[model samples]
Target: MLSDQIKTKCTLPHSLYRAQQIKDFEGEAAALAGITLYSLMERAGQACYDVFNTHFPDARQVLILSGKGNNGGDGYIFAALAKNAGLSVQLCQMGVPDDLSGDALLACSAWQAKQGVVEGIEQADFEKADIIVDALLGTGLSGALRPEYQRLIYKITASGKPVLSVDLPSGLNADTGAVSDVAVKADATITFVGLKQGLFTGRAIDHCGQIYFSGLGITKQFDSLCSSSVTRISYQDLSDRLTPRSRTSHKGFFGKTLILGGNLGMPGAVRLAGEAALRTGSGLVKVLTRQENQLAVIAGRPELMVADFDLNKIDDSAIRDWATNLVIGPGLGKDNWAKMLLDFVLASDLPTVVDADGLNLLVDKPAWKDTWILTPHPGEAAHLLGCSISKVEDNRFSAVRNLQHSFGGVVILKGAGTLICDGKQTYLANVGNPGMASGGMGDVLSGIIGGLLAQDLNLQQAATLAVCIHGQAADLAAQQDERGLLASDLFPYIRKLVNP
Candidate 1:
């Protein structure tokens, strides 16, 4: 039976490294768990063979593309196994076999004694194979794709055969998930040792068509290493955080949430936010919208207490008396009236969850920065930080950290792997999917965080729970229909997850 630690270690949270790193990390741990690293490698090769056979059992004529690393060593081992299994195996070297050293060379010698070998890859040979094992240029790649490897990648991409990449799809940045000019587009990528974060996001999603992970039976060793606090939250886990209610519980137990947004023509922003706050279990929800939106606020959702007029209509004294914890900047336009209201809300003593246009206005004023959670997408974060989108993408860890330092509060940088950085610590949420790249997603997330805040969670706790639950809900919804999953798809599920 696989232990939970081993099951978890099968998917690495970081990038790929030299097989030696895998060996060093897993060797001692596997021994303590009553296994060996070499034994793990053998199991890895066997897993690859099993996957290949299960997926393409009739592909008797096989082409094993080997590099000069242990990844290639894995390929050589599998090639020998395939040959023994009565398949016509051809060992094609992207680099010369003579250049292979260490375990890779040992595996190569074993293959040479059995299967036929070739020094160079041929286009005709590639066309003739029913299946191709892409072991070329595994994890140690950096900078750009090598020219020779680039050409091979292009050819393999054009081949249209079943290509199973060993470890990561070569030429892709393992840590950042960035792909250079060329990368092998594989049918299935069987990643061993650990699942690199790159495999699920950015260009990786396209290059790696199907992802399969194998622990190679050394999970306990890898888990022993210290890890970043970041994790992918699923619905099952999020639901566990919900405080089960007793029949004796009353509304007074939950705190009030004040939603301050909805400029002149955008009352719907606060409308949705207020409703979401109520839905998320805030005892009382209030909406401070433009006076013109008073009727709409009351008509759209009568359950909320709508504060009349813009923020300017009410003095700091009045604003202070109204809200407990505030949520600002959902559909807040950049008009002067909206700006003044935003300033008043920012200057207020209440803890705030800043989102949408509120963040835009805060970036402009540059004052009101302490214990406020600033939520922004890549473009918005770039604007606030005054950097290009590429710079932010190049290093998200730095970008999020910079935001928290400048703003003096928790920062939720929303994107593929949404980052919640609280100045000292950082958490990466890997729950969401591509289908969630639509409008109104941030709006919902802001409201969720606001509700948590109203429920008396600290700024950091509110942000963490809100972001995790949001992504977790999206992940759960995706299980039903990944292609059609939307931001609103998480609404009902979010309520269930938070209140379970």
Candidate 2:
């Protein structure tokens, strides 16, 4: 009921611009907004100042690590504002102050006018500051950090003080979310002009702890000029679609999710998937497994229809008619029995969400189908695309897009920030945590997608909504105990989110 009171704004429709795109519109956006470049810089600095004060109310000395770029200009402006606010401020320059120019030059002058002295990194003290702001690099950063910058950043990170970064974290590739050598780990980041697509995916998650965004008064201009290639999903975007069902609604109103897995020794895998399907609002869930593991899969879950009887005798068409959608993978092995089951499913028109070992089999003889969702981790995706895991890791955006085009279905590249692509549109889920690193997570994700598919959601909606729900459920479970989090722990949260 508390969720009902929370206002839902224009949430998930917000576009995420690439680093280049954000830079492309900065000057024009400022001009169109009836503001100057320095004025926007001042506003960016002011926004950061207000947020910094709120977050670090007891902060004594605000230490800002400034570089020679426009990002440093923001730092200088922030330092000036901090001084005016009667807060202690310390400004450290990465290079000689003589090198600063343009808006940055004006910002530095404004800071000096406030009697704030700038010191070089060699003379600055790290221990005296409560919160450190990293303004060393912005979107222009491409290659790895220089040796000097790495040492200082390492020192700042190892200091354990809460760090705030301006724009993108220093040394992080703002476009691809790739990090070379080292990047600053900030407790919170204040971004100006636009939200870069890189900050929400890949290795960027580790560096960007909490993000604080400000359009710097160019909201109208920025929104009009940019259209994101990808979108970010949150609960607000989908809450209306997943509202409580009518009082008269029955279980049969939802679709049946038929799960085919649990091949010989791996009985627990299929059980996890089946239970997740039920938890996520599937009307009925049936598991087709080997006779040896049928009892083990249904030991504690009596709701599931676990069947392996007469599978050798019955035809493939009989199984297809029993369910609305299919989740084929979680323990689907490469053995003959597994292959036979795969071929049988292939003969049907059932919409399917594939994962785990089933993904392995599909890679060998790839085919196209619009009614399928492929969930592949970096390793599995590498095998399917015949490329190295590092290549997939290097540029996840391109990899996911390639996978969708090659596989002809909605593809979910699972990782830190899961990427969901359907060849035309792409979406990103930023709700998961590192605790979801445990096993059975992917299996659970496949089941959730299958459950949504059973509810008659289209390929894109099922993939997008399911991925966000799965990740957010993990986050909720992880809050209690992230380190010891289990895939099954998400059951309660999944049930709650689906009902919200």
| Tens digit of per-residue lDDT, candidate 2, span 284-389 | 9999988898889889588888888354654756677889999988888998788777777677778998888888998776878888899999999999999998
Model 2 Cα shift for residue 308 (angstroms):
2.7
TM-score (all chains, Cα) for each model: 0.87, 0.92
Q: What is the C-alpha RMSD, rounded to one decimal, of candidate 2?
A: 3.6
lDDT of 1 by residue, 1-500 (tens): 22232223224344333334554566666777787545665676777787676667778889888887878888888887888888887878875888888767777787788744655775337778898898887676868887888888888888888888888788776666667678888887777776665665455657876666777766546767524444444344445556777789787778778887787778777887787787788888888777788789889779989876534356756656756788888878888877877767766777788888888886678763666889989888898899998778766667888888888889998887777788777766666787787766787788888888877788877887888788877877888877766666787878877866
Clashing pairs in 2: none
Candidate 2 residues lying further than 4 Å off, grouped into runs, are 1-13, 243-251, 309-315
10 residues in a row with least lDDT, candidate 2? 1-10
Q: Compute the lDDT for candidate 1.
A: 0.74
